[model samples]
Target: MTFQLRVLLVLAPILLPLRSSISQESAPTTTPLHRIVPQTPAELRELFRYTATRLPIVSAHRGGAGPGYPENCIATFEHTLAETFSMLEIDPRMTRDGHVVLHHDATLDRTTTGTGKLADKTLAELKQLRLKDSEGNVTDYQIPTLDEALRWAKGKTILVLDQKDVPLETRVGKISQHKAEAYAMMIVGSFKDVVACHRLNRDIMMEVMIPSHAKVQAFDALGVPWQNVIAFLGHVPPTDPSLYEAVHQKGASTMIGTSRNLDRVFHRRVRDAPDSLRRDYQMILGRGADVIETDLPREIGRLLYAPLSKSPLGHRLLRVE
Candidate 1:
């Protein structure tokens, strides 16, 4: 036989077993991933494809809480497992003891009852401090380690590690060791950091987070389809298209918002205020964004995915909603 046919013959047996092993049980629900693990890369890729059709999927900015779970707490991460959100945004940092832990802000004062730098605290000390909600009310939730968060991702939604202040190598290393691709998978991290991490481990999904409209070129060249672009509303007289276009032309998807990635914006920032946050959303949607991360993901899905709009993912979301 020819070389190509011979190679195909050699690989067929190895591939058949993987296809057979995909035990897809339709997005597990027991406390957010109580069942399912051991997924193949092919199965994971297919799942990602189907979910993208439901674009603008809810991504709990900090793993959405249930009734009373504080934001970014383990409870919230578990709750997210039950939601339809295709992804979750989580922040991870290192403790003084060199253990990986989860928290958003670089400092510890705003989130926990503790009053010092997070890096200054040992894992035991960090765990001693209870986490607080946005209202500054303390709850029973203690800080969680990265291992806990990964456990929540097991055969559930994707994890988008928003480790803005952590070293890329460290974050990527932990995710790889877990073999998260067998469960949910991650974008690994934001724009600048992910570039280095991708070169080190190209199999990992990379996401870019932008504060300003610069640096889309370097991020797009990395060949990843998803890049989380931060959407803003200030500094223009309205009708600004430069930044979104810059990212879209690079073949990477843009995550726009009237504010940051949440798709909510300040009403005061829009010059004419004619552009509702949704209008601003449509602008980037027009740019062919592969995904839109918004707090109002349901509304965006309704409008963009409306029957008449021809949005690729809209139909499915509308039916579900």
Candidate 2:
């Protein structure tokens, strides 16, 4: 070998470690996690039960994904938990090979490196692809399975599983199989599905749409106790105060989805009137939304962060570090 080649080879080992060190230095560091741990399914229900002093909660829409974090990945979930004690909302779709994996779209083209219908691909095939962030930026994260997410969430954060292609029966089965009733719940769009879930496992909590007084009455008629459900009012605040009062009167907490409304406004005007935007969020809470489900969980969590509640359940269950 030439003298220059020999010298270069000798320096390669030294250069590689320096390069690695630089990468490690720039990598995101995790802070002490802000986690919620309910020891049992009963406690989990009690945690969601509407009360005068209940702590304000945030549900991380699509696991609080952002520029670097891909939605529904466990890593993204952890990153959100590190910042605030928020529950995760994930989409679970079935693969061709019959595995349930976390993916948001009907097609993989939007949120992943893969193309075409996600249902056509096996879990193994999906494992070969990488997930993408909301801005369509390719991320290093891989698609995670429902089982993997359930296992990871046990002592960390509660998961609210969105009904995508996965049937209500399958999602309930996965939660039952994992004994995840303590930290896992499902979103049911209809009262019949809610009833099906309750029949399958009464202990399993559910997020149900009760957007109007009529719907609230219909839900009440279903005879599923309010404690077993968290009523999702809608994407915006209710036009009638009675809607909030109706749900709260049933002893169930309420959730407002701000992803389509307030979250957009927050991101749009955050630089100008941040305080005013924050008040808008507070206004939702003031108007009787016990929970805020948003695309920007970390930002909402920070803005809505309140002192540990004096309520016994809130003190014991609402943990943040």
Instruction: Indicate which candidate wins on TM-score.
Output: 2
Models 1 onward score TM values of 0.63, 0.88
Q: Residue 274 in model 1: shift from native, Å?
A: 14
204-314: candidate 1 lDDT, tens digit per residue: 654545434555555556564442222222322124456655544543444433325323342232223433543444444443343545443223333333332332323
**Model 1, which residues run further than 4 Å from truth?**
1-54, 65-67, 81-83, 182-195, 209-251, 258-284, 295-321
Over 106-151, each residue of candidate 2 has an lDDT whose tens digit, in order, gives 9999899999999999989999999997678998899999999999
Q: How far off is residue 150 in model 2, in Å?
A: 0.1
Poorest 10 consecutive residues by lDDT, candidate 2 = 18-27
